[model samples]
Each structure stands twice: as C-alpha cells, then as structure tokens.
Target: ENIYLNGAILGMRKREINRKFDEIVDFSGCARYIDTPVKRYSSGMTVRLGFAVAAFLEPEILVVDEVLAVGDAEFQKKAIGKMQDVSRNEGRTVLFVSHNMAAVRKLCNKGILLENGQLFASGEVSDILSLYQTRSIEKIKSKKIIENEKLGNAEFRVLSIDAISPEGSVLSIESGVKIQLEFENNIENKNIAISIFIVTLEDLILFEAPIIFSSDNNSQKGKYLIEWDIQPFLLNSGTYKINLLVGESQKYIVYKKDDILTFEIENALFDQGLNLNRLPGVMRPKVDFKISSL
Candidate 1:
C-alpha cells in the first residue's frame, strides 16, 4: 500500500516506503501478516491495510470513499474511531462518504450533499441528513407500489397502499393528508384489528393508531378500502415510511407489512420566502406558545 501511495504504482518506490509500510502494519493490526503476499489477503484485510496506510501517513488531507464498509462491524467502528482521533489530536481533515446515516451522523460535523454531480446542499451534518432523507422519499413518490405481500396463509392481503394529497397528486405530502389502504379479507364474520404506523425510514415508529373492526365483524369476505387521516400534520420535514398491520385482537398476526409505503413531507412553512426546512426534531407542530411572569 505504501509503495503504491508513494508512486510505486509507476514501478518506482519512495526511499522510505518500507518504514511507512511497517508503521501501517502495526497500526492496522496486520503485523502478523507482514511476510504474506498481498494477493493472499482477504478483502477485509486489504481494505483495513489500505485505510491504515492512508490514515497513518499523516497526510494533510485524507480522502476515503465507502471502502470502510467492506470491513466487519467491529473494524468499521475502530476505523471511525481512528478517524475521529486523527481529527481531534492530529488536526487533519478526513473526507468520507457513506450511505450509513448513523455513521455519518456520528463521524462528521459538516456535510455536503450532491445530486447528479451537482451541488445540492452543504451545511451542518444534521441538516444535510434531513435534506437527504427528504429527497430519498420524494423519489419513491413516483412509484405505485413500493411493496406487495401476503402473510399468515393468505388469510388477508394488502392490495395497495398510497399516500395521496387532496389535489390527487402523490408527489408531495402537505399538512392534513390521508393514507388510503385497500386490502382483501378472505375470512367472513371474523373481527380484525387494523393498525397504521408512521415510522421514519430508519424504522423508528413515531405515530401509531389502532382501529377495531368489531362493528364490521359480520361483513362479507371481499375487498375493502380504508382511509386514515393525519390531520394537523405534526411531522417535521423528512422521509418516513408507513406500516400497515391487521390481526385478530392485535395479537394473532394475520398480515403485517412494514415499509409498504413511503412518503416525503415538504417544508411548507416558510419565513419571508425563505425555506424553514431545517426545523429541529422529528415533528413540527403549529401550537400556541405563551410566557407570563409569575
């Protein structure tokens, strides 16, 4: 790795390449394989060795792609920690890219987002993540069915789930929207519990509602439509997935589909024509606030 980094890829090694290689081998925990040929190394070992070389060389700037993800979880953790230590103690700049939002949030302070090779958003890490999350969900709006499946011996099946606006467009979700679900119940004269969950794309459940179908227990076995209203929408601007579950008394699972629907909530609230898109927290509510002297 050092030979290549020192222009040895062109068949000329730097005078101190051996010293550099030894330092990296000790740091990357590859000292035991110093005598092994590079071709015999595993993919994970190669990645670790490469990263160790790049990180320990004391370069003014380190450019890292998603290669760290090739290593195992423990190695990834250690690698991130090493980068953090480098930044804090050595005062070097590390440019990293990864689809793992949690890791990005933990490792980075500033973030730059790109789309189609064009600059999209550049700001604090938290804001950039929110923007990325929102764009990801917007892309899903163009699709009809994100997922379709049957569960529990096909006793029930969700046909389609859609998040629609009153204007009949699925591109964006405004305040006070509705999610429409169409499903088929194969069994007649049986009560079922239906539940809808509003969850972040990361699988964190933010809101959930349960509906008892006892009144419709005697309904015939056939297809049905249900509309769930999210009035006074308090969700902050970000990407979120929807989950639909149906079962007997909410205990016995009949059918449960997770991440079946995804939607993007726009930052409609603006100030003086400026977008207030960076509102903190997972939810934004229009509530009155008052402070009085006691």
Candidate 2:
C-alpha cells in the first residue's frame, strides 16, 4: 500500500481539480474553440475578458499579476470579487501581486514580499504589508526630496509636507491642530490637479484633499502653499502617516513622496485593559454593556 502511494503518477494529486464537477456537469457538447486567435485588444478589454474567463475556468491554483489595473474601476471590483469566490467556494489557492496595499490586505491571508530581486519576507499578509510600508517610508525619508512629473506630462516637484503635533494631545479631542504641507513646485502648467492625503499607521487614509490653482482654460505658474486644520481627528492611540498625491482627479496617483511619514498619537488611560478591550479580540470600538433576556 505504501509503495503504490509513493511511486505513482497519481502522487495523491490530479492536474484537473474540477474533474469531478465536470463529469457530473451536462456539457451537451457545447465546448469548441475557434483557431483564429484575437491578436489585438485594448489593455482594458483584455483584462475584462481574461478575468472573466479565468473566473469560470475554475483551476486548482490561480495566479494573478498586477494586470488587474488594466480594467476600469467597476471591472476591478468584479475581478477581485471573482478571485475571492474561487478561493472560498472552490477551495483553491490564489497568488496575487499588487502595489495597492489596501487591496492586498483585503484579499490575501498570506503574502510574499520581494525587495531588490530577493525574497524579503513571506507570511501573514498583515505583517508583510506592515514591513513593506515601513521600508518604503524609510526610503522616502532618506531622499529628503520629493519629485512629481505626472502632472500632465510635465514636472511638478513637491519639496516637503511637514506634519505637526503638540505634546500630550489626543488627536480626536483636538478639533483643529495645524498641519502643514510645504511644497516646492514650478506650477507652470495648471493642466492637472495636485492632491494630498493623511493616512493612519495601518495605511488607512483618514483624509484626502486637493488643490487646483488653475482656471479659465489657461495655465498658471509659480511655487505653491497649502495648509489645513484637522477637524475631529478621530484616531485611537497609535501612529499616523502622511501620503502625498498628484495627477488627474479620476486617475490620480503617487507623487514625490512615494511612502508615508510617521506621527504618534497619545491617548489617556482608562479602566480598560492594555492595547485593546479587556474582553477579547483585536479591536476596542466604544461600547457599553447591558444585561438583557429574551
């Protein structure tokens, strides 16, 4: 029995995992292929078709690259949902790669990180994402310079975005803490817009604000200044980050600052336990307990 188990092409595995389902399915000989291959399609079309077909094919193992970005916004959501369905219902494995850290955290329970053509880390997706964000932020800070050239095929360099906090202040309680974002830009062409974001340490974007200095169908030029006051900065005791953005409003992207800047939030102590709720689990949303019976 052991010899047969170890030394066989079966090898306790099969190439077509959906074979059982296929046998039970009523094909009715509807499967056929046209030999004339489609040699051309816009990147968006290709993604729509590819993701749709792969969703239906239901392979044992699925691998998706960054090609998901090729589709439009609506299609991207569909593709993600499809991939998730395949993994959960079909009990299959999926390998996905993306620069969108938020999406990675949402879709994957496991992660593989690569840095400089080498394996940096591989484990729980949250841990890997945290490490990746840390590394990216460190590199961004080291440069001490942020450059932006995606403003309508022209250069718009952002010199700095300075984050500020007073001593012993809960961010949520303090309604209006002055946060400064300093920039150095020629701003010679107002063909595009500039945007900025305030992200939490966990990469949650708390706020995103944009500044458009051009109007009346013409280009404006010069250095720029942008400042804002935080309102009800509802972040629990933890570190937060600053993320900068620049591009068209609909299809905007990362600008000079390729990573996040860190700032710590201080919270006053209560009767609750440490780091989280005394009861259990990983979160501590404000709540009150009441005893009741039905």
Q: Choose the strongest candidate by TM-score.
A: 2
Against the correct fold, how does model 1 do in TM-score?
Answer: 0.55
Model 1: pairs clashing at backbone N, Cα or C within 3 Å: none
For candidate 2, the lDDT comes to: 0.55
Estimate the TM-score of every prediction. 0.55, 0.57
Which digits, one per residue and each the tens of the lDDT, describe model 2 over residues 158-262? 544555544325443333244666555444544456666767544566667776645544445555667766543345555556666666434555254534355
TM-score of 2: 0.57
lDDT of 1 by residue, 1-294 (tens): 443553354333465556566667776677888568778988878878878877766677777788666877777878888889888788989898878777788889999998998999899998998888877766655442333343234677777777776666543324556889787777666678889999976566888988777646555578888888786447777667888778875568887766667777776654686755556577777777899999
Superposed Cα deviation of residue 271, candidate 1 (Å): 23
